[model samples]
Target chain A: MAIDPPYLLFLGDAADELAAKTARGVAHWRPDRCLGQVRLPGCKADLGLPDKTIDQGAAEGARSVVVGVANRGGVISEAWTDALERALDAGMDVAAGLHARLNDVPRLAEAAARNGRRLHDVRHPTRQFSVADGKTRPGKRLLTVGTDCSVGKMYTSLALDAELKRREVDADFRATGQTGILICGEGVSVDAVVADFISGAAEWLTPANEPDHWDVVEGQGSLFHVSFAGVSLGLLHGSQPDALVLCHEPTREHMRGLPTYGLPTLADTIARNEELARLTNPAVATVGVAVNTAAMDAGAARRYLRETEDALGLPAVDPVRDGVARLVDVLP
Target chain B: MAIDPPYLLFLGDAADELAAKTARGVAHWRPDRCLGQVRLPGCKADLGLPDKTIDQGAAEGARSVVVGVANRGGVISEAWTDALERALDAGMDVAAGLHARLNDVPRLAEAAARNGRRLHDVRHPTRQFSVADGKTRPGKRLLTVGTDCSVGKMYTSLALDAELKRREVDADFRATGQTGILICGEGVSVDAVVADFISGAAEWLTPANEPDHWDVVEGQGSLFHVSFAGVSLGLLHGSQPDALVLCHEPTREHMRGLPTYGLPTLADTIARNEELARLTNPAVATVGVAVNTAAMDAGAARRYLRETEDALGLPAVDPVRDGVARLVDVLP
Candidate 1:
């Protein structure tokens, strides 16, 4: 599903920046596609764009209204009906990554239908996917894997995509999660797909391309994570990446959410991921490391990066602090 | 959802035995659950049970009308509506693994509601599942993992459960797919679940039990199958199995449905599965090999089994021909 841009991001009564993380991601990565921001009265989050009504956003050439705030249950609040309907009436489509479907709200559904606009539920897959074929597609792919969830896989991937394009390379950032979808304006959340079609969805996200073209895929869950290794494995096999950037959070003591599980070493993580990846792309290689050093001081982060590079014998960098040029330099 | 036992099996114009394999599986594994069979006029398959009308089967104490035949596309046939309604009217629930929802058919919905009976769409999970917490539960568990798709994982699991019971071991066959669900009367179709909840559904299926109780989980796709390894890995992690039976089809040259990929060596499969399974269960062991010898002659199969045992240094048995007693003997 291609969500049209420029978007008027609606942060409806979001209590914190984390609630509006999707909007923030879009603004940071695709500022040109973001026309304005619309906030409910009690909203505490901001995307730093001009506040505008739906009519103003439409008049300013916004093509869609993105519900970028995530509530406690990822539900569209009834508080959003007026703004969503207004966006539809103003000739803009509405898109959201919510647990509740936008079409479930009769008023928004009717408004969209009346205006002949689409309602994109980014979290819910609208199309049926066949099982993965494990075919060897042309072109190159670089997938960002992690030692744990939320360890900058997306950040590393986007940075790599941007860096590759800067050097006159044909590259695309393939999103596999909600925030990444908002940033790219289109992508299926691989985690939300049916178990049988995880790899199929990934293959569809990055199809055969020009021989030198690169599809930098955002990864999900760790191979070492008991709760989500399946999603990771499926995505890995489907992505068929020639190069992988391992993302890690150095300060974390245990796996995210699962307090009892400890993180695997970067060596074990790389070795295991490469072994599993050989099923789809036998020439797959771990080219570099992307360390999420947000939890560390600059000195500590630098030390960790050095230690990781020496330990794994890969080019290591914090994609946020340093660019991904080195990582791209060793691309196969 | 518990599908009531003593079923009236419906083979609605099935063109071949393979189409009615689900019915045959139920009849074979749980013969006591079969009351009689209902075949449409052009039905080409039979379960070797007394032919009876829905009303006759209901009068004879059938608790549910099982739509056991799997038609092309897994859709509920229009021709079966008469039998379904008659069964509902006669005070019986209806269970099916069809892709089409039973409640979507107005007549079946009205009939079921009128009779206060339930309609179980076993392939589509109606209940919401949480993300897997990856907690350790008290129970002995055995999981049957395969070398590729359709390598008799469910068959081996069922055989082990039956044999365990015969040997006075407290065990339950935990079904993770549709046919097994019909055989066991209840299970979540783990592959049909949303990708994120694959492991969670598995965890829900086999919860904490008595220390001596064993949950023999039916496995899904292989660790090396590109199309479905995620489902396999999720099942492995969530199952937290102490012992794994490596199931394989001796004659298959390639992975199922994917001509591009070949099967991994049983040694690789066992090692990889054991390594990944260590994420949840560190002490997990590959206890034995379960061979699908249906494609081989008796003497050849026996020799092949002996060779496989020598190669892997594990007990190798065909669950159908030799039972799973040898596999059980090597259990952790």
Candidate 2:
């Protein structure tokens, strides 16, 4: 689902800055796509962008209004209805990554319909997909896999895409989750898709490209995650990545919500992921490792990266601290 | 998801006996659930049960009218609406596994609501599911892992459940697909579930039971099948099976729909499935092999079974030809 930009980022009455994480991500990664911020009167969050009302954003040529705030329950609150309707009336599409669909709201739906504007519920796929054919498609693809959920897969993927682009190599970051989707301006939330079509959805997201082009596909879940390994495996096969970047948050106690399962060792994670990935791409290689080192001191992070590189014989980097230049060097 | 039995089978204008495969499975496995078969004019399929109208079947204590025939495109035909309405009008619940949802049809919806009868779309899940907790629960589970889809995982599961029960062991067959749901009278079609909930749905299907009781789970897809490995992986983790019965169709040339891919070696299949299954059930073990020998002659079938057991050092049997007694004996 392509969400057109420049976007008017909605930070509707957020409780705090953290509630505007999604908006911040868009402003950080795709500033060119973001035009301005739209906040409710009592909103505590801010993206530090120019404040614009619906009419002002429309005048600025903003094509879409993104509900980028992460509300308490990922809902579209009643307080934001007026602004959303105004955006539609102003000839701007509305996109959201919320648990509640934008199109499901009666008032908003009627407004969008009246104005002939699209409502993109990015978390839910708006199109039907066939079961993955598993036929390898053309293009160089790199996928970010993790030892668990929320282990910097998206950040690593974005870094790779950015690094490859900086090197003047043709590349695209294929998002697979909500925040990633909002950041990329498009991508299917694979987890929301039917189980039968997980891989199929992945295949659709990173379709055939030039042989020299790199599709850095954002991964979802982890092969070791009990709650979501299925989504991970399907995405792995669907992406059919020629190169993989293993992502991990070293300080994580266990899989996010599954306390019973401990984090898998890096070696085990790589071996298992490569094994399953071989079903579609026999030449699939783990090019590098990206660690979330925010929990560790600078010295500790450096030592951990060095030890990881030495032990696994693969380049390791903190995507946030160190750029992904070293990681891209080993791309298959 | 349970559609209470005894069921009045509905075979509306079926093209052939093969169209009634689901009904035949139920009648063959659980004849006690079969009260009568209902046929529309021109229906070529027959379960050989006593023919009855919807009103007559309901009068005979049939609690549900199951649309047991597989129509073209798995659709709920307008031609069959009258019978379905009559079933609900007669105070019996209506159930079907079709691409078109039962409740989506206005006529059927009206009839069902007017009569206060439930409409069961077995292909779609009716209840919301939480993500798999990955915590260990009581009860032993034996899951059938296949080398490809439609290689008799359901049949193997059912056979194992039957064999276990015959030995006076407490056991239940947990279905993970549409036919399996109909066969068991209640089970989720895990493939139709949202990708995020595949494992969660599996956990719900085979929930905690007595420590000694067994839940024989019917698996879907193959770890080697690119099209469906995700579903298979999620089901494996969710099942948390103590024992696994590897099911294979020796005559298959490639991973189901994927022409370019070949099947993985049984040794690799066992190793990978066991490696992943251990995440949820650390003591998980692959106990035996179930071979579908329908494509081979009796002598060749025997030879193949013998070769499989000799190669893997696992007891191998043809579920339909021989029983799953040996497989059950090796259960942990």
Candidate 3:
């Protein structure tokens, strides 16, 4: 429970291979709270963080060490375990988003316990959820939908939440996946729930009657993605947002795992998402776009953003790079 | 386990309101095995089963009493429990599709045990399922998809299965819901599975590499039904059907819960389902239409079928009224 901030990221040798999805999420939303990144040799992506050794990071007031890269099969390598132990020995708490629990590894658990530090496993569901009954909720809801998976749903939602807070607007970010759970400290892994209860998990994440507040919900798989469409639809119905922000990764060529299906254009995505949202709330509207320009150059990213904004006639931004302020301002 | 059945259907008073879904399913697939119907005076829809009292049904060789109607909330009523007790006292096994388990009710369980009869709770999952790997299977898969909830998905699947058997074709029916579970005698309720494992449940139901047999998967909720779209998509991906049979009710005014969203035309439904099925298998096709003309008059039903057949240019049949022989012949 004592999961205070000032975190050191353990990207280690895995940084070059995997996307470091979890670390990127934390850096995007709580940049100032991050102390530095620790990587082994050949860690290519800068991730906009100052490189620091485990001792230097701990000495510089880092209270926790986060295993930030989401490796395939969620496995923690022996090298990563050594780095985690070094951080634990330095009296820092340890947190992970991997399916392989850090607590289950006796060495990691013992190291943490010896230092009187807690271990946080964020992918595990922290509470039970009821079935969604499709009832109308009270407070204004904002959902971030993507044209493809792993675009920028969590980052956009958190950026919007941060922007709203900066503008003195009452807003909250609700996470629905593993990485989001690591960043937000709480969430139901909607994909892990029973099919009948997926909507209920969505509904419980954003309850009705929050006075003047806005719930910026992180979306999951795309409705067009063959592998995870059910999870996508459940989250869509559960959020029942009054306004939506469509997220698109400009470089992806086709839907994930479904090479036969092409990605929908921004216009197609907006129309498709709005049609789904309207199933639960007739007045649901598309407010803006959150374009992921991670794979594009500065000029191309800006040009693409401008063209998308002009074509769709809506505010568009790389939520992490340009911030979601313009998108937040458009919220009604 | 010894659930031999010359079924005594407990229609009770619900027969006037809700259809005897379970009984109708059994009768459609195995009518010769059903002993008769037991109704509380004024019970109308004959379901083509002979009417018999509890004592009469037992004397005539009824070995099981089936709780037929899918009651609201799946709750077993006191009156229905009394009938179940009478059947047990007469040495007949009791089977139900209710969410409430017969084993959980001590009196029912005790009565059945005293008479050396078994209690069957069909809706509960009978097997564990692995996660879907999205691997292509060898045998062709055919899934029955509906335009709305409860538009006779099970009936269509069973009818096609029967037609294939009559033609001496190698085909198997795989159930995904409660009623289908009762008729098929075994299946994991896909809706009850975790969202991440829905596809896995589908994979386990019909594994790949069947040299010649066709798997007829029974679908659940519609892709457009807001409350249950997740279940629908999961079933679709899991089946990876080579061909899809679109089920539609001729008289449904709106898409289930969304009063504002109208039903898609037959052409639209076919196009939409094929697109989804193609996500996994590009060669997916729509072979026929299964029209539910249950609420129409005899002459009107025939006309509607003829018109739909002409408009779609596909084999169209009332799976229950006209059988699925023509539709089966169209499958590749």
- In the range A251-322, model 3's lDDT, one tens digit per residue, is 999777666568878897788778767767889999999999999999999999999989999999997689
- Give residue A255's lDDT in candidate 3 (0 to 100): 78
Point out the worst 10-residue segment of candidate 3 chain B by lDDT. Answer: B13-22
Once superposed on the true structure, which residue ranges of model 1 sit more than 4 Å away at CA?
none
Q: What C-alpha lDDT do the candidate models reach, one value each?
A: 0.92, 0.91, 0.81
Deviation in Å, model 3, residue B222 alpha carbon: 1.1
What residue pairs are clashing in model 3?
Answer: A132-A200
The better-scoring model by lDDT among 1 and 3 is 1
- Per residue, candidate 1 scores C-alpha lDDT tens digits across B201-320 of 999999999999999999999998999999999999998999999999989988889877888999999998998888888889999999999999999999999999999899999988
User: For candidate 2, lDDT tens digit of each residue in B1-332?
Assistant: 68899999888899999999998988888898899899999999988999998888988899998888988888788899988998888899988888889999999999999999999998999899999998899999999998888989988999899988999999999988888888788999989999999999999988999999999999999988888889999999999999999999998998888788888788988998999899899899999999999999999999999999999999999999998999988787
Candidate 2 differs from the real structure by a C-alpha RMSD in angstroms, to one decimal, of 1.3
Best first by DockQ, ranked = 2, 1, 3
Error of 1 at A271 (Å): 0.4
Candidate 3 off by > 4 Å: A1-131, A210-212, A253-264, A310-314, B1-24, B27-136, B209-212, B251-268, B282-285, B310-315
Better of 1 and 3 by TM-score: 1
Query: TM-score per candidate, in order?
Result: 0.98, 0.98, 0.72
Top-DockQ structure, candidate number: 2
What are the RMSDs of all candidates, in order?
A: 1.3, 1.3, 7.2
